[model samples]
Target chain A: MQYTSPIREPLVLQGKTYADVTEDICRQVEAAPNPRWLGAMFLSLLALGWGSYTLYRTWWYGIGEWGLNKTVGWAWDITNFVWWVGIGHAGTLISAILLLFRQKWRTSINRAAEAMTIFAVLCAGSFILMHMGRPWLAHWALPLPNTYGSLWVNFNSPLVWDVFAISTYLTVSIVFWYMGLIPDLATIRERAKNPIARFIYGAMSFAWNGSAKTWARYEMVALVLAGLSTPLVLSVHTIVSFDFATSVIPGWHTTIFPPYFVAGAIFSGFAMVLTLMLITRHVYKLQAYITLEHIESMNKIILLTGSIVGIAYLTEFFIAWYSGVEYESYCFINRAFGPYWWAYWSMMTCNVISPQFFWFRSMRRNIYVTFALSIVVNIGMWFERFVIIVTSLHRDYVPSSWTMFWPTYVDVGDYIFSFGFFFTCFFLFAKFLPVINIAEVKAILKSSSAPSVIEKEEKVKAGVKLTPSYNPKSE
Target chain B: MTKHEETHKFLVGIFNDEDILIGAIKKLQAAGVKLHDAYTPYPVHHLDEYLGFKRSRLSKAAFLFGATGAILAATFQSYVMGIDWPMIIGGKDFIAPPSFVPVTFEFAVLCASLGMVATFLVSNGLLPWKKAVMFDPRSTDDKFVLAINLADNKKIEEAKIVELLKANGAEEVNTKEIKKK
Candidate 1:
């Protein structure tokens, strides 16, 4: 057996064996939903309903029902769209980038983060559909052959790039997430007691046999997908930033937007992961699998990315002034001191200032503080998008066209609607799927040897049978 | 009976610990035992190398698929923009390859990923409706089961194989007759 310093912390606490890992995860799926899960689901469904109702109203009344005007054309919809897309970055970062880096700490949280990526992208995609106004004509974004004499989508438009980018990101993420779930799904299929459960889980499992050859191929496929996804995730947010940077708007016209947006994306993505994971670990009582060490490690990432984002914010300001472009300088000045100064300042406080608290060990370890700051970070990111979009567009060089934009009820409703959509999917995902990746967790058990494994080893030495007695009663 | 209709008997050795399983696989291989297959709850890092399995061809397949996707993306965009409807926007040429890049990149990734996963599934015979040869349910949960097909060779008795397994620290030994489907 591999020996290390006794003081070193294990990734999985409580000395769990391979069997216990399977049991712990399968037990979550096999057992009936507890009151807490039911409560969260109930609340999520209610919000989903409310959001759907609001969206229906928007559909009924048309785009005029929104707070949008000629001047501030893109407001909360685009902000929320960008924000959701950015939130998805953490999942890809955890699952793909960290996989390539061979970071073991990621194994505990990658499953949930990947799921969050899919759901967040779903939310982000829906906003674009709604933002298009004539959702029926949304097919125009695709490069499909048209009835009107060979008309094609604008190849030069970043918006068209977004259509391809978002769809491709969503597809590859689903495939990656589903591929990772196969072995665990097979495990669930075998453990399932109910016939219905067996059928569903079995189909989802794709009849995985856990053979050595299959495992080898599975790893190869996973590695290849991860390789594909790393560049794909970076390009996704870069394309998203292109939506703004390609525009003639002074503040939006910057070369640094791509890397800045990417960094901010990872920052907000990690923050969202922390927010969800903290609650998930608490709610599911999975402290043994998702230890404080995991939380601390994630916090360190947040601090790093958050600082990069802060520097980006400062760089944008310096460049705006350094370029000696009057309109650009004025745009930055107006953002910090003009009509929407509050939004700009909130973005700074949340994205730049709040995450710095993670520099201290106590702040990183404090769950409540981390949770609160995560929400603050998300709030800041939303405002960051808002400050970039509305503030830049709300006041233009033509002072006659300048006007302060405010969100109508529908605007607020749409934001809530997207959150409801996000949460509904998340709640369902949490309940149905193994929130933790069981197979990956099993692989790490040797290193993260829970105390129980040590005790079980002792029992085996004392002549206790190694094969766990099969319980037909449970079956 | 024809080979297709014949049922194969497998001498299965179940191991709780991975270390013991690896040792047994090495010992069995050294003893000139022709192994059928090994099943585990999770992927063992160097098990395949120890068992003398060939390296996977999935990466080569991924590269070909990715190249196809990239070519398709570039060709499709070029045809649409340059020939079909050549309306100029942003004062750029209709066949501006720079603008085609994002779509091309996305398509390449999408194709490469989906193709590789599909290849993996098909290669493993793990389609949704396919039947898996389940050696033991515990293999998916906790046990590492090493199965040797008795039908393939008649040189060794079942008892001798069982003894070999037990002596090498197998938690349990059993005979299971698996049908060739």
Candidate 2:
């Protein structure tokens, strides 16, 4: 019988002092010019100017300058809104949900994922604010009391709920991410040579001292906040789901929305994470920290979430027919075979069929394939939102109100700017923050590096004791 | 005081599984031995209750911090947008609840998070303390340890400790005695 010792090292990578790890990351960042710096800059510039021009046109004219009319009151604008919201989900899920599950791989990827959630949500808000015919008058949607010109805001409106949800999610995320960064910040603070770098990291570190007691309490607090973040993350998407689920549109209102929307969010979110991570791994050359195993794990999540979203599509179709409502049935049928049939099929192919490749180990492990699939998944999710909003709203109750709505140049430009916003923030975050948690990684290393004296002594003692006890048995 | 005057013994029984550790703690509790501390690399569920820990008041911290945020945000928004400036747009009232909720919730969460972090840092005395010389670095890696100081209880003797640890399925026994120079 094997007698197992109680004391052992579970963390695989340990003993990497803050200096070693930070140097490694800095060295990587410094040595590489991001390979595509010029390209990224050029594209970003092109998109920025074009996106600015698009907005300038929209502001100069009106929201009416685009293709939206009465029946199809929402078009690419709301579609982008939902798309960005869905994209935001993957980050929080990686950081919070994976943390709860004790998935160690999450440590490598969560910082970037959390950053993505914040930026994507911001991009999403841009859509809603821009969608408003009178964007400046948007403050009226808020609830202030009378006399001070404060009016009671209706809690019933999903838009009102959204003001709470997105704001809460972003703030909570900032705290969670910052807390994780504190120890790492201290690490960077210690290692930094330059005055500016030293000051920046020092302020961010907030005088973090790596004491045992501090770690105990910090871990406790982090776990508790992680617990709080879990529900908040789920709620943000569920509330976003409610925007469509609560509406009276025949196709929009459904019981499956909350879970379905959540699933779709994760699917799209993972794809974006993979896409960025793929570029980052190549750009910064962080192959060791962001390993193939980590990519495989993310791919697994993408597959699972994608499958869940796929099942939702099937369920929605079956239920639409099973419920036997003509309008609902027609909505589903029109989605599959309507004027926007190409868009609907594209969504299905990108979301459901494409992710199926991850079932193969080769595809999941391949950086290029994973990166390509992620982009496909993102595009598919965007179209899914478009189909849901445009198909239902475009062909509503009255036939005369039905019109094919298309995106104008302004619509297209904002779409490019949305990427501009996402990439710009992500690039800045990568350059500044410890993208992979340094302290947690260091803690893991410190524990794993040494085989303790206790274990060595225990082995010696066990050996001394065993000689006497096993004599009879051996004889 | 004489240095290294050997007296009583602390028998720390080691177990591979969490369930076994739990059962041992319960036995120790039942036998009325005051637990010095139990250290595990990873958190074991409900091990704290076995060791007789009170519920953490981080929740209270969260609540207080959250309330501070709510009040501060509300006051700020009310003062800035509602009373002080009073910029009216689209005939809509100022001091909007929806707008208030965002800032309030943001501030609340912010306070709670910062409060939790700051309180943790201060309470733990973590700011660049004298480096805690490691007792066993491997403890953080993957180990469950129950520390029993022999001097803590008069009832526990050296022989009895060894017997108890052996009975509780300890893999090995070793002694650590503090020396006074």
Candidate 3:
């Protein structure tokens, strides 16, 4: 018989049967778009239009259209790049790390989170191209055989490492996400009455039969991918950190960047997940699947990661002063008291102080508080990147050359474009795909459903007790 | 090549629950009846062991693919940077293995993930255009299905097999003929 801990909160509520799981998830995919979805899509398209126009002007007039000056060359572009890339981390962590740990709650959220990873990575990648000014020559980033005067991409460069890391991360994430979607796609294909829908889902599903032998191999593939992805996810951000840490700049150069960046990435990522999931839970009416317990578990992670980030912040300050490096010490002091002090303080307040509220269990579990804090945390994360990129570059060793950076319209528009792009992709995915893994949720139903619901079920089917004895503590 | 069609016959048993299905499999095996295959909406743990299937070797495949990627990356970087056109930048050595670690690790993971998934899909006969031989479509929905091939179990009478399925809590017993390519 299946056994779950007595004190453990149920991951799935209302004791949903396998059929009910299928029906509830599939109903959203099969139904036509609701007014809310359409309205959101329209707003996203409008932002995308404005972003596209600004992107065109920037490309046409060259990088001069951006607010970047000689003093602060890498301003909003790199900040957004780092922020979005950091947001992409939560999906793989949810799918790969949580799966390896055998967290059944991941089944409800992994699909959407992984989808977010793919889209967020896409948004992050666009910045790399946008910053290049001439995106058409993007092929030069690849280590192709020297066609231009016998010069190859420097393998030693951290920028070169980013190309490999980001591309590999995106490809593997898509393969992993699509592999998980096949079985659910087959379920949708079977239920679709329209021939067009049937053919589309059927082809996408690759005719999965769900045979015991196939499932065995499928599970094996999933496990191995998860194993590979765990290290890959960590490595991707580490390489991104290397881009800054390898530089000789006082504020940017630090040994603590890799771990600090990773912790911050997960912190921001879980916040973004909470932001999207809270809305998704409401819109799709998936409260039974994504319960408060799931939110609490994610909040606990945010609390842990946020504290780690806070500690990292203090450690950076301590090292700067303790090492007796005047440049490094001055960098830290200037960040807090300089012209960009508002941005730095905002980062500290939003990222460092805001998440501390989650220390209280009630705040962690409250939906409205969680939702507001999630957005606050993301705003803090964005400023964290801005503070790191802008504050460091705005004032360097040459005091005469140091100047404050201001954003042009293109910078703001380009940022809005990513929102438009991300939400557009997410809305389409939610409408067409099963936002939750139907099969995985079904697999956990017998073991993780609420005990009280099961007891009620047992009473309805008298003399047929799924669990031999119902423990009162399960309530 | 000309297309060829094949017809296969089987006794399909429909089960409402996975627990009852597992129990039925054990009982049917004790009756000395050879089974074809079982299908379910979700994974049924230990069902493979009850069916006496061997452990999957996809992990080994992943390891081999990963090794190939590491070797390929190390060799390619060494050949290009050390021998082909070495340029000393930032006063670093011509051959730096430490710098190669990030790309090598990333490529290894990339190769392993893509290769293993390809192996899985190919081995399982899952392709976008491939036609599926389904005993019952409900197996992909909410039902558990167990099929016993008539040709594989020639000694067992059809009537006796049907009776065994019913006695072991199968909700329905039916015959299905599947066309295979």
Candidate 4:
């Protein structure tokens, strides 16, 4: 007999049947694009068009289009890179980490979140390519043999580590996401009335028949992938932190960088997930699946990670003073009181102070409050990266070369390009695929469905009769 | 019945509820019936064991692939940095093992996940163009399907098996003929 604790809230709320789960999730994919979706897609395409022009200028005219001096060389580009990469973390964390922990709420959000992870990583990677200036010689970062001696890529360099980490992270995430999509895609395939839809979904689904043997292997694969991804996700941001931590720069050099960056990544990632999911849940009418409980659960995570980030901020200040290094101490003081003090304060207020509002139960559950804070937290996160990259570089040991970094239109436009790219990909995914995982939801339906629904289903099962019907032509 | 004759014949039982399906499988198994396989829209817990399937070896394959990746990464890095044109850029030694850890970990995870998933898809005969041998299309939606091949159950009559399926709460019992490729 299936049993669940009475105290535990149902993950799949409302009286939803197995068939209803398929119908509800598949409705969006089967239907034509709504007006709201069309409008959003149009705006995204416009931004993308503008951003593409800036990207063209950056590529054609080179990094000179970006406002970069010798001292403040890596400004908006690296900051956006780190920001988008951080946002990518929430999807894998939700899909892999939460799956290992058996958080049932992850079921409703993992599909969309994984898609977000892929898109965000692509956006992050574009920054790296753009920052390379030549873009054509991007393959030089790889360890391929060339005529310039037999020199290989330095594995010791954290930048090189980033190449492996980011690529592996992206590849593994896509594989995991696609594996999960097979069963759901098969569901869509079986339900599709249009021959085009059927053939496309059928081909994508790899003709998955949902056999017992296949399900057993599928579960095993998911479990092993989760186990592998757990550490892989942690290692990704840690390697990203190494890009700064290994440097001799005062603010950039910190042993606490790994854990701090990881926490901040999750914090920002959760905020991004909320930003997308809140809008998605509303647009697609998926309130029954992506319930308030999922939002609140995600908020609790944001609160926890935000607090850790807040502590890391304080810890950095303490270490700077305690180290008794004049350069380090001056760096912290300059960040707080120097020319770019506004950026520092914005980071502190948004990343540290704003998430504390989730301490209250009402605030966590309030849709408008959560939505507003989600946007605020992301803005705060962007500021956090900006403060780290620009402030630290703008004022270093050499007072003669001290300079303030300013973003040109190209810098701003390139950032807007990522936004356009992320949203366009997301809107298309939301249109074409099942946003929520259908098979996993149905799997949990029996145990997690409401007690009333279970009773009703049980009664129906008892009264059901044998009705053998043959339809060979249906195949 | 001949092997060719029995290969095409199957006794198909459709179930709405998983509990009834599991119960029917138990009753069918206790009567010494040779069950072919069962299908469900979602994975039913312990159904593999009830159907007499061994635990999957995919985890072992993952470990093997992961180890291969780690060894390959370490060897390649060491061969390149230590032996192949070693140039000391920083003050660090020519062979730094600690620096190799990040790449090694990433490569291992990449190999393990990709390799395991590839193994799973290949083993399950899942491909983009492969025609799915579905006993009931509803098996991918809401139905629980229990399929028994007649070749493996020659001792039991087909009508008796159908009756047993009906008695055990199968919502629908039907005969399925598998067309030869």
* Candidate 1 C-alpha error for residue B79, in Å: 1.4
What tens-digit string does per-residue lDDT give for candidate 3 at A1-475? 4578967878887767778899999999999898999999999999999999999987898788899999899998999999999999999999999999999889999999999999999999999999999999899999887656667889999999999999999999999999999999999988989999999998999989899988888999999999999999999899999999999988899999999999999999999999999999999999888988899999999999999999998999999999999999998998889888898898899889999998998888899999999999999999989988888888889999989899999999999999999999999999999999999988888788864444655676796645423243422
Question: What is the C-alpha lDDT profile of model 4 across A1-475, one tens digit per residue?
Answer: 4576767767776567888899999999999899999999999999999999999999999999999999998999999999999999999999999999989889999999999999999999999999999999999999898998877999899999999999999999899899999999999998889999999999999989998889988999999999999999999999999999999998999999999999999999999999999999898888777776788899999999999999999999999999999988999999999998898999999989999999998899888999999999999999999988888899878899999889999999999999999999999999999999999988878777654345757656798532212122321
Task: Give one digit per residue, the lDDT tens place, for model 1 in A230-301.
Answer: 999999999999999999898999899999999989989998998898888888878778877788899898
Whole-model Cα lDDT of every candidate shown, in order: 0.87, 0.71, 0.91, 0.91
What DockQ results for candidate 2? Answer: 0.10
What DockQ results do all the predictions give, each relative to the true complex?
0.77, 0.10, 0.82, 0.79
lDDT of 2 at A58: 73
**Which 10 residues in a row give candidate 1 chain A its minimum summed lDDT?**
A466-475
TM-score of 3: 0.97
| lDDT score for residue A256 of model 1 | 92
Per-candidate count of clashing residue pairs (backbone under 3 Å): 5, 19, 0, 0
Clashing pairs in 3: none
Rank list by TM-score:
3, 4, 1, 2
Task: Tell me the lDDT of model 3 at A85.
Answer: 95
lDDT of 1 by residue, B70-120 (tens): 999999999999988897788899899999999999999888888888888
> If you assessed candidate 4 against the hidden native complex, which CAPRI class would it receive?
medium
